[model samples]
Target: MEWLERMNRAIDYIEENLTGDIELSEAARMACCSSYHFQRMFSFITNVTLSEYIRRRRLTLAALELQHSGVAKVIDVALKYGYDSPVSFARAFHALHGITPAMARQDGIALKAYPRLSFLITIRGADAMNYRIETKESFEVFGIEGIFRTDGDGEAPQTPAKLWEQSHANGDVKQLEARAGVLPSFVSQDLYPVNAVCSYRKTGPDTFPYMLCAFKEENSNTDGYTTVTIPAYTWVIFPSEPHQWEQFGDTIETLYRRFYTEWLPTAGYEQVDGVEFEMNGTKNGLNYIELWFAVRKI
Candidate 1:
């Protein structure tokens, strides 16, 4: 099935069963995909994580009912929305809407509502993406590494680029490059706790450490450099258009959106790993960009 259509079906299912128990795995099954792929694709396509979207929708419905319905107690409303206890429900509700349930009930407080979502795919950009599938054994990369947080979904923090920019500006880029052996990879976990994202940290005084790393197998001979050998795996390598120099963030976003919405489902492949990264090819007028995403056959 087309991914968008399957996503639409998933959305319908969530709306229909909003007041009942909903399983993440079951939702992916309904979409005819694996839980990992489904959740990743959902985040890529919608720019919102699956859990966040669900919570918003549930809270929206609950808040509307709280204001309009004759439900007497907030606990009843919370239970109806699948919360185990009023305290848990109240905390979540307040976090999302900026108002507690009792406060909403007492004075009929107005709250921000997360409306139901529908999937819609649109194409606007004219640039063609350059990408290919790669299969290789594990390798090592020597660079800097750090961890950062994603505020809501998988949003990129300002840290990564700032690190890169500072390195470039302070002439630390050349020093690191002298020690740079292989290109690096970005390692990430599929399921992260709420509001926390992995960050990047400098590896050494001269060399920035790469948390998620990648490199050719033959170049693992750097002095004082640790080796992180990745297992043999398949990857999707995307070459960015030459026109998007210094616009790494936007270019990557566009690529992910397309992969989630246009590729993947139709390509008959399922995502297997959270390991993703970019290869800094020789710069060409600030437009040469290539991104690599690790994947495996499903």
Candidate 2:
């Protein structure tokens, strides 16, 4: 459980610095992974963004202090929690505890509490994940991309989600498909060829670069698109069991959650520094996507 131990050390760093500036990159270092991977893994495991978790923790500590310390001023508590002013503090406090900070000091008052978080092993069910490993030559893809920041202060970073919405709304999705020629059988016909591409090497720390791209063949139009080459590497591709289009988001979330929590801990390979693919395809009259992870032998 070395990986989990490293993760806990990162959490310890956050808890110690909750009232001060938290360096997300340091947390990732403590966990022995990139900031991008740390944020994503934390979200998948906890079902909450790192930022939201931090907010709840700060509010939880504030409530406890208010309820017990008679001399602790509300404004002081707000300041201690890094809130700029009382009004902003109160708003955030009320959102979490359903009562004003002053009201928290009253007797018989009830407030919500979010305890510190830690990870441990559990008996996961025997659900199988169908995956294949392959090493292919370098390939190029062309599409539009957006720069997204990683949430380092335990905040959730809005990302690929926003990119997906923009592409769909702006007709980038339709345009890419119309420009695409004949694709391999493995390619998805339901939504896109490649739904989203995220990786560690193509960008900087504290930043996640995502692209809504498709396989760029020779003579593929390069205008109005950014072309990137995906270097050759061993990939572990997990093909999701087919399900309705309505279940797309839920299905993908489940797949990620399981991969990090259940599979990686025991797998013989470790995820390396490279790009990941969310490839779209269809099966059983439904939609599916293959999760392509860059990996190397552990």
Show model 2 residue runs off by greater than 4 Å.
151-159, 184-194, 200-204
Regions more than 4 Å wrong, model 1: 2-40, 49-51, 75-127, 145-175, 182-226, 244-246
Residues forming the 10-long window of minimal summed lDDT in candidate 1 = 190-199
Query: What TM-score should be assigned to candidate 1?
Result: 0.60
lDDT of 2 by residue, 1-298 (tens): 7667888999999999999998888988888777888888899899898889999999999999999997899999999999999999999999999999999999999999999999887887787777788887887777878767775332333667766786788888888877665564444455455566787354677787778887887646668888788888888888888889899899888878788888776676667753688888787778877888888776
TM-score of each: 0.60, 0.88
Superposition error at 87 for model 2 (Å) = 1.5
How does each model score on lDDT? 0.61, 0.81
Backbone atom clashes (below 3 Å) for every candidate = 21, 5
**Model 1 per-residue lDDT at 274:** 42
> Pick by lDDT: which candidate is best?
2
Task: Candidate 2: count the clashes.
Answer: 5
Error of 2 at 222 (Å): 2.3
